[model samples]
Target: MSFDKFVKNLSEDQKKELLMVLKESTDTDNKVAPKLVPKIEDGSFTTSIQKKQTEGETFGVPVTEMPRFNKFEDDGSDHKDKQNATPDVELTERRRPPFKKITQTCTRCDNTVETHPQFYREFYICDRCLKK
Candidate 1:
């Protein structure tokens, strides 16, 4: 018989007793199994590790923080002074230029299309021409 049918046939007291037994078994199993610790390191994949001789405490290489840059006060150019300058501000995003969409003309057909400028120049063809 299917498990659902068997469960349906069981009395209320029997179901309660079965649940209690199952819960106790799960609790025991959890207690028996050792909890795994994730190994977190720079440029290393995160992996679950168990207690073993090979999984002993490892010395990590100390990483130096990026040097903070301060604007030259005595520069000849007069720039607006920042009221609240944070040293821990990220430098990457501010340095990057925003992407602008590029427009291209289809060589096969006299059709104009807008496309992002790529590193390698590619010939633009209209979708209708490409389908043919």
Candidate 2:
């Protein structure tokens, strides 16, 4: 019989005993397995610098005690005394040069034209004969 069918046929006491046995097996497996730790140094198994930094009290300062600047507050000063008070030159957006069209002969018609290549069986043809 299938496991689900067998489980369904079991009595309440039998189900309880089966669950207890499964729990005990898992507990024994955990106890028998060895816990693994990654090796760091070539000479000794010392704790990493990152671990030391995280554990030490001197590594970091509280955010409330850190230095900060007030961005909104501006000290008032005379504008005329400052150098380059007004800009002499104006800035403008640059325009790109137009694309240069290339001419090629169509394989089917032997016509010279400046247009995108149209695909034939294994060769390129001009637009006029490509439809045929």
Candidate 3:
């Protein structure tokens, strides 16, 4: 059945019991509650670009000169240098251990098994409880 229909079918006593269970499971005084307004005042957050622009500073370097490279002429000197160079260091590859699965117990069943916790809320109820 749909959640709304199931909830509506519950008696007054059942509803009160569910509410009591939920209230007991949660932490009412959590410090991570979201703020309604920003901590800083208006126009307080400034970026580097905005600061530089305000001071009339240029953004990037001017392209006044171009780079030059030497022309390649093969005289077998590079090959001779490679042959003369000796191995200074050795490198070894490392292997990591395989991941192991973690198991959690269902709060309702009190058994050691994988359990799905409620999203955006506290409490773990196994598949058996969920079906009910």
Q: What lDDT score belongs to each candidate, Candidate 1 first? A: 0.73, 0.72, 0.64
Best by TM-score: 1
Residues 9-121 of candidate 1 have per-residue lDDT tens digits of 99999999999999999999988988777656768766667655443233343334434345558864454456544458666657768888777888899787877776224
lDDT winner? 1
Which candidate, 1 or 3, would have the higher lDDT against the true structure?
1
* Cα RMSD of predicted structure 3: 37.4
Alpha carbon lDDT at 105, candidate 1 = 82
Model 1 misplaced stretches (Cα beyond 4 Å): 1-92, 119-122
In candidate 2 the C-alpha lDDT for residue 30 amounts to: 85
Clashing pairs in 1: none
Deviation (Å) of 76 in candidate 1: 56
Candidate 3 wrongly placed segments (more than 4 Å): 28-132
Ranking of all candidate structures by their TM-score, best first: 1, 2, 3
Q: How close to the true structure is residue 56 of candidate 1, measured as C-alpha lDDT?
A: 27
TM per candidate: 0.27, 0.26, 0.21
- Report the lDDT of model 3 for residue 72: 75
lDDT of 2 by residue, 1-132 (tens): 899999999999999999999999999998898877676666985765764543324436785676655556556565766583886787886797666666777788888777533322345577789688
Scanning candidate 1 in windows of ten residues, the lowest lDDT window is 55-64
